[model samples]
Target: MNSSRRLVVAVAMSAAFALCLPFTANAGHDDNGTDPDNRSQAVKGFNLTANGTKAMNHGKSQLERSVITTSWGGGDIEVYDKDYGDNGWHGYADCTDWNALWTSCDIIRVRFNQYSYKTSSQWKSLGCHEFGHTADLGHRARSNDTDNNSCMREEIWPLYYDQHDLNAIKAGT
Candidate 1:
């Protein structure tokens, strides 16, 4: 092939490969900035709020647990319940609201269902998944059941925050 033609072909192939790359299954209310240049919050904090009757129960507790455990003293992290109103809290189960600002990637709010759709364990994993997003984690493609250990995986099961997930959060920050 001609050099010019080869270069064009190579560029096309690279683009194709990038497009094929796996991404996390995320539901957001606004643009979740993927560009590192656009975000800056190094440490993330969560303000667990209630959605009216959505009391703070085991599901919320588990989500908080995931946040604390995965962070591993990454930085200033907070999880509080009961009197905190839904002022800036985002979604955890029903809907998620986020905006990757130039100053911080930390989540502004989290909204979570009381795990009415699945078992407690399943929601616990799901909670991790949602919090992972707050940590600026995207969906990752799993290679095996072991990969399911990552809270960043698109599939919510075998919920455990893997090194990859932690790294992603740190990188974003």
Candidate 2:
């Protein structure tokens, strides 16, 4: 029985690794055209939206815990199933505006294709990455600085907001 359990665990781990290998190998950013800066903002208040994809849903909780809890002026971050009709400021699973900034995140899409190909953790990390953009964070452009664990990094995984990310939040406030 112990041997059988071990086999099951190994199989599960292997599957997870396989699902994530492609992403790690090609961890490129969508590049929404913003330069990295330490401009922190207090985020007076904003109504954000997200699609109902599994990854987006999971990401919503993570963002709320890590990012929203620190920023956001006590407003609701709406999660919906439909895409933004006018593109004023919303998040979608299929949005092409990855990490886009237009008058404050007209949308925060997570690239729906990721939901089918990547693991929940990967999508969650990407979600945080997009949210980082909402906080006015650009991609981490420093190449030699391998110590960067910021979600703003072009590659998403082992997700967590670094101190620089926190500083970005404090830039405009």
Per-residue accuracy of model 2 over 40-81 as CA lDDT, tens digit each: 212221223232344444444444544344333322232333
Clashes of each: 10, 12
Candidate 1 total steric clashes: 10
Candidate 1 lDDT by residue in tens digits, 51-155: 321222332333343333332222322233333344443234211223343434333333454324445565556556655555555566656325457655554
| C-alpha lDDT of residue 25 in model 1 | 38
Q: Which residue segments of model 2 deviate by more than 4 Å?
A: 1-54, 57-111
Off by over 4 Å in 1: 1-107, 114-116, 143-146
Worst 10 residues of 1 by lDDT: 34-43
